[model samples]
Target: MAKASVNSPSGPASVETLTTRGRKTRDALLDAARTVFEDVGFPEARVELITAAAQVSYGTFYRYFESKEDVFRVLSDQLFEDIHHRGPSDSTLSPAQRLIAANRTYYQAYRRNARLMAIVEQVATFNDDFRRLRHDHRHQLIDRQARAIARWQQEGLVRQSLDPEMAARAMSAMVDHTLYLWLVQGDEANEALLLDTLDQMCLGALGLDQD
Candidate 1:
């Protein structure tokens, strides 16, 4: 059976004709690739390192992935999925509560995947496709948040004067950059204080503090 297709530098590539055992092997290679990338970064990472880490032959690596970059794309896709968060769906909760819950979820996910995130950050600096992928993912989050803010504004839960998209972008940057510093850059922080302050800042920016 065909596995999910991922974009390569040349074009889209599919992992064609995989059995149950083949799927396990492919997953092993991906896990090893993630470890290697996190340990040595994208530029230093090699197929041999991944194969060695996976305990698979170098030839086996090519069966699942076309190249190092190909496997990295798959890893990046997984990282994106891991980090993607949507706000709480409980309609009974107040807007402020939902926002706080969403922020908490995002922070927790970032903490769990900080190493991979750092690798992706480094790769995005030099790789055009990775850079675009990173931006697109961030923008998707921002757009969703913007729509939420607009809805809150319509409900009179947010300040009418604030532009939803701009506010969303600024608030998203505040949360994302702060997490990068604390988690990826190893900045010292009190976890409770950091999260609480982030919640307050997000609320205050939207005028939800009044509620």
Candidate 2:
């Protein structure tokens, strides 16, 4: 037998190729995990199922992540990042206008990703990692809304009795409940109807005459 050359590109090429393949394999595993989580939910979902679905080996899974929850955290962060991809903007518009813009953006997003949103909410209810993310995001959103409410208060547009923090949380709750009802009821409440109803509710809460 001819002496094998240790310095040949063939030997090095095999290692380089495997390294590249490993990255592709990791991405595929994450993608498969997201799909499985969406279908079966986080609590009921299993790593073996995700790896099997991706056709990746158990050892490969360990090389990428410590546990299924690690993958879940990545997915949760990506989901929020996608939701905020539009970017948040501060407005010089009136308080009510700001409210409408914010509410409309949320409504549009919910309509586009109702299933994903529902799954995220369900998962957050049970998963501590997801729950922390959910709470953190909600706090950020409410803080932004509270600042908007404060602006209106400074302008004397809204009643002084209106508490910005409380108002923001109330508005968030209203939007959440409305979305839940719409999702569970199958179009029983249309967007236009929801907008009108929310407008009325918000105006009443803010002590503003409908304009």
> Which candidate comes out best when scored by TM-score?
1
Q: What are the per-residue Cα lDDT tens digits for candidate 1 across 140-192?
A: 88898999999989998899999999999999999999999999998999999
Residue 81's lDDT within candidate 1 is 79
lDDT of 2: 0.72
TM-score between candidate 2 and the true structure: 0.74
Clash count per candidate: 0, 0
lDDT of 2 by residue, 93-198 (tens): 6556656666677777766656667777887876676788888978887887788778878988888988899998998888777887687447586668878788
Which residue pairs overlap in candidate 1's backbone? Answer: none
Residue range with the least summed lDDT across 10 consecutive positions in model 1: 1-10
Steric clash pairs (candidate 2): none
